[model samples]
Target: MKVGYEFSKESCEDPVMKGELLLLSSVMFLLYVVSGCPERCHCHSFSKSVDCSQQGLVEIPSDLPPQTLTLHLQDNEIHQLPAFAFRSVPQLITLNLSNNSLSTLDPGAFHGLQHLKVLNLTQNSLHSLENRLFHSLPQLRELDLSSNNISHLPTSLDKPWENLTVFAVQQNQLQQLDRTLLESMPSVRLLFLKNNLWKCNCHLLGLKLWMEKFIYKGGVTDGITCASPDTWRGKDLLKIPHELYQPCPSPPDQVPSPAPQPGSARGAAPSLPEDRSALAECELKAKPRPANLRYAIATFIVTAVVCGIVGLMMLVATIYGCAYAAVTAQGHGGPLAPTNQPGKTAGKELLDSPAA
Candidate 1:
């Protein structure tokens, strides 16, 4: 019984030793990685201003040196952003956190960042953005949220950032854009909406009209197919054309169709078949048919066949006529061989020999 107990104790000690070894190996790897750490904690400097952003940082280090300005933390495995991460680095102007595994941004993520202007959060796996996430960064100008899993822009994010100029939401799963969302913005200049799954239906007509008038088009390419089938499918809608969105008439009892939406119209609907047939006619008339080549080929073939038949008839007639002439001459009298004294020549040689 004592021996069994001793053996069990030794086995437990073996597992503990293995755990310690793994922890020591991890520490060694971390030391090797941060061996070339900058003068300050968690900050590596290439020059007086440039600093590494998120270089395998599990947490924000103690302090960053004064000279660090632009921080690049893109393409990291950072899951959560601490509140005071950039407290000491107030001089950082450009913060790039693109292509990271960041799932959540704490409300106080950018608390002390007063000088940050351009914040790029592109290519992240963000599902939803907190409305008050950028409340601290009042001086932000460009906020890029492209290539994320965000389905829609928050309607309450109206006054989050006042001076935002460029708002990029390209390559998202947005089916429609709410006009209220646009109204919340403070006069955005460049709005990118390409490569999104925009449902081109009656409800989305307003946004399309806005895009058409503003010329800030959606759809990166013609391959940006429609998301719904009620009206649109394999169609490419960049800026809604004026002709394509005629309104359907409303009954007297029914409420009037919402007055001329952005991508819609207020007039009567034109016949779709008429438009298609007109387009077909236009296309048919635009291209000239190769009737001249067809004519040339037909003439050449007919002439060749006629010439072959005439040649064959002429050859057969010549053969038959020659045979008939030969028979006729044989019937009358055999045609004499052209010879000078042909029968007498042999006899004349005998006569001459006898004389000699």
Candidate 2:
């Protein structure tokens, strides 16, 4: 009987041990398949995606395969992109580097990335981007920079970027954007610009017209609300009354108007000094201004607003003080204004103090 009991217990333990062995073998096989990735990354050749998110990476992975199409490096500690960082991965199409510490980009950061299409740089510390950062990326389409310290856009954005369709710059420090920047991006259909400090004033008139055209063309914009000019603050820029931009000056078309010769009669309007000034101003307004100039102008406007408010307050105080003194003088039975009914000093005004 004892021998039979022992045999039954052994029989039950044998199957348990075999099951554990099978599980361990499967785990080893999975690790082998994932061996293609780096120490902290997970690479899947079948999916052509390499996931290295939240890996505490201070720099880009050195061993990423050239066959990788979708590379995820979000939630890393990478700061300041080096030039040609992606020179080896011409095949990469989608790259996710959001939630990093990138502040600046080298001019040639994306050199030779001809196949790169979608790039995510959201939630970084980027204040300004290099003008030529994406010079060689002919196939790039989408760019995301939703949460950053970007106060001004790169001047190069006024040209190139032909295939881009989605541009997300929501929740930045942008007070104004050059309409030419939007005009240059003729292919963009969806623009995210919510939660920005957009100053709606005469400076924003051009952008409003562009927005109207964009809306007509079935483009999408999200909550482009104004944050300045006390009257229009918190108002949706697109919904503002058109009369607010009264006497809207149209930009000078690229097709030049026929210039008048010295004796021409009908074409002399454009040659007038005022007309020339208007055209020049419109032309300058139509294009993107230098970043430094825009910032200087923005600063000047803010300073002027502050000074105006202070001056207005002072003027009100002075008027009130003078009125108060006049009323007090009348109550104290002091000199009143001389009657103008052919009395003394009627023609000469008040030559001296008048009797009460």
Candidate 3:
């Protein structure tokens, strides 16, 4: 009986001891993670989020957890970022460095962050970007550079980055942006460019074309107001007539060779269909609409008919009024007083008299 009781007690104690050990292990692991977290930041291993925002950090903090997925380093005083600064973070998805003082980034700043999806650099002091800074980000989807000082973008952006979707560059100092540059982001769905110094000259013809094409394709965007060339200032970029811009130069179908005559040499060169289309486009795009023409013709006919009726009525009234006055005068005169003067009408005698 003593042996059985001892065995039962040991079994019951074993399960309680195991439960206590498990709880102790969990507390120790929590303490270890807390101790390993970087300074001036709060890291949650469970959620894989590191928030180091507004910490006056001049550079990225070291010892970021390897499994970090989201890092919020916004509102820091970081001025420059070296190449592959985030190389240690391969699984990082969203990196928000917005409202920082980042002026420049090394070409390979985002090297090994292959899984990174969104990058926000809004409110930075960036005037331009290294062409390769964003060249190889495979899974990058959205990039926000709004409220920056960027005047131009690198031609490298013209290369297609498949998963790229949203590119917001509003409130910048851009005087002109090439449609070809915007074309690079073929997969982009939204382009927010509201407040920029858009120089609306012949140089803007391509942007104007892009705006038309973008709208036709159901792309959404706010109205862009022209900032210069006083003629187009304050006007919505989309609403301005394409005719306002000078036509783009058409590429010669065949480089003009002196193989033709002197006077007609210009016409002798064979033109491609593209050239013909461009020439047609160059012609005042102010196409005459049949609806407007028909409306004008109908208006003219209606106006002419109304005027003719009015004139005819006036003429008839004038003739009737004159006849009525003459008849009434003749009737009131009681059979036209016999004129003493021969060959003179009594009406004339009465008209000639002072107060007849």
Candidate 4:
């Protein structure tokens, strides 16, 4: 009985010790993961978020945990992003790199972030972007690029961003946006476009047309004010009348004119009358002043003419009224003069009879 009791106690103690060892191992593993975080960064185990912001990092860290889902690297001194910068953290979903001095980015800077959804790059010095810079981020949804010095967007993209929803480019030096670039992001609902040096000419007419449709479809955007073509300065791009765009010269067809055959009569009149007509049409189109200025002048002239006609009509009416009033007074005055004279004479005769 004593041996049995001792053996049972030992059996219970062994399971208890194994349980203690398992818990100890888990704690050590947790500590290892926490210690594995890159220097100057705080890693959150449960949320898989890493914060390295304000660290004065001159470049992106290469030792990011593979499971990191969010990264904050804002307010750093990072100046450029090399290709595959985030390849070690392929699962990153949110990357905040705002307020950095980033002026250059390799075409593949964002190559392996397949799950990244949000990217904040506001207040950078990026002047331009490569067409294929964002090709790897198929799931990107929100891209903030405000307060940069970007002058233009890529005319075309490698692929359409079907999931992109919010895009901001406000306070930039943008002169115009490519209509095809906007069309590529069909799911975009919000656009930030204020404070740009918009050039409201034929180059921007396509964007104006696209904006109309985008607004009608419930998309929201701030005003885009024009900064060039003195006539359109300070005017809203969307408010400019479509008629103002009509004077823009249409792009000439790419069909090359047949080079005159070798030794063909030098300076010979063009054989085809159509060629002469087309050339004349192009010259005429090119020499016209801006359509809006012409439209304004025409409007002003028409208004002035109409106002003059109205003033003349009013003056004529006033003259006719005065003449009619004078004629009416004269016609009635003749009858009133005789009627009052008879009354005055009868009153004098009645007074004389009373005296007699």
The whole-model C-alpha lDDT of candidate 1 against the native structure comes to: 0.67
Model 2, residue pairs in steric clash = none
Q: Write the per-residue lDDT of candidate 1 for residues 183-296, one digit (tens) a residue.
A: 566556677777777776544656666555454433221223466544565566653454554453343335333345466555855333434333322110112334688899
Which candidate number has the best TM-score?
A: 4
Clashes of each: 4, 0, 0, 0
- Models ranked on TM-score: 4, 3, 2, 1
Candidate 1, residue 29: lDDT: 67
Roughly what TM-score does model 1 have, to 2 decimal places? Answer: 0.50
> What would the per-residue lDDT of candidate 2 be over residues 149-179, giving only the tens digit for each residue?
8999864454447788998999999988878
- Stretches of candidate 3 above 4 Å error? 1-35, 158-160, 248-356
Every candidate's CA RMSD: 25.2, 20.0, 14.3, 17.0
TM-score of each: 0.50, 0.60, 0.65, 0.66
Which window of 10 residues has the lowest lDDT sum in candidate 1? 278-287
Tens-place lDDT digits, model 3, residues 111-130: 88988899999999999876
Between candidates 2 and 4, the one scoring higher on TM-score is 4
lDDT tens digits, residues 299-338, model 4? 9999999999999999999999998877887887643344
Which of candidates 2 and 3 is the stronger one according to TM-score?
A: 3
Off by over 4 Å in 1: 1-50, 58-62, 216-225, 238-356
Instruction: Give the poorly placed runs of model 4, Cα more than 4 Å off.
Output: 1-31, 250-356
